[model samples]
Target: MITVDEIKRMLPHRYPMLLVDRVTELVPGERASGLKAVTCNEPWYEGMPDTATEEDYHYPWTVLIESWCHVAGVLVTWDRPNPDVRSGKAMLLGGIADAEFHRPVVPGDVVEHHVRLARQVGETYVFEGESLVGKETALTIGRLTMTMRPASDLTAPPVPDPL
Candidate 1:
């Protein structure tokens, strides 16, 4: 088991963005399971209109996906110190596929993400997972890919005109 403080060390996310609260299970380079508590105090809830409909009040799907990715991040980096913190490298979201949101997540919900390593190529890792609220699945990710590289490489030079 890993505490929130330890998870903070493994992931670059913080405050409202740090979705994973604790890791209950981890198998280095294999799989991981983590939890996140959804609360009305989150930044996303700020300025929400009092008259907003149920659809408008749903938790952002992107953040839910990111929470799952954070769990996968722990699984991928389990064998080494966090590259984002230790070496100033950046861990990035490369791609996501077949991501389906099944139910709306409310403020009082506790999301549990279960992730498995699907593949790895060089510094890129692919994961398959699902996010659940109790026994009900909230979302299913068919494939999610992440890549780690020097932060300096993130800047784009320029695009030339087609000849």
Candidate 2:
């Protein structure tokens, strides 16, 4: 069982951008299952057309793709005991294979991401992931090919105040 705090240690994502809320199953070198509790307060919800009136907005295609990638990364990155230098770093999207969206996902939905390791070719780890909302499969298929990168690439340096 992986808690939100434990997930923080495994991946560099945080706050608004961090997607996975919990991890129910983590089988090293095989698969992983994660949960994302989507809510109306999510930053993306504000820009959605139907969100202003409290109606469920059609989830953006890009965000759905990103979410799939994030979960895939988590599956691969957490496959082994994390290395010291790898902590706080992120898995960069090296490529994608067979990515296809099946249905729409809306707000107030609990998205469950299931990822399986497809193969590791050279420096890239390939993962196939799917997102489900309740009994409906919102997204049927996608693959994330990723390589690890420094945390600095994902974070901005602190700006100093005027003296």
Which numbered prediction scores highest in lDDT against the true structure? 1
What is the per-residue lDDT of model 1 for residues 48-68, given as tens digits with 9 covering 90 to 100?
889988777688999899888
lDDT score, candidate 1, position 9: 71
- Whole-structure CA lDDT of model 1: 0.82
What RMSD value applies to candidate 2?
8.2
How would you encode candidate 2's per-residue C-alpha lDDT over 1-163 as one tens digit per residue?
7887777666666667677788888788788888877766778776656435533566766777677666666676664433343454556666665677767777778888888887776446767778888887777555666766555655653222111
Q: Candidate 1 — worst ten consecutive residues by lDDT sum?
A: 154-163
lDDT of candidate 1 at residue 51, scale 0 to 100: 91
What's the CA error at residue 65 for candidate 2, in Å? 2.4
User: Where in model 2 is the C-alpha error above 4 Å?
Assistant: 47-56, 79-88, 151-163
lDDT of the structure predicted as candidate 2: 0.69
- Which ranges in model 1 have alpha carbons more than 4 Å from their true place? 83-86, 156-163
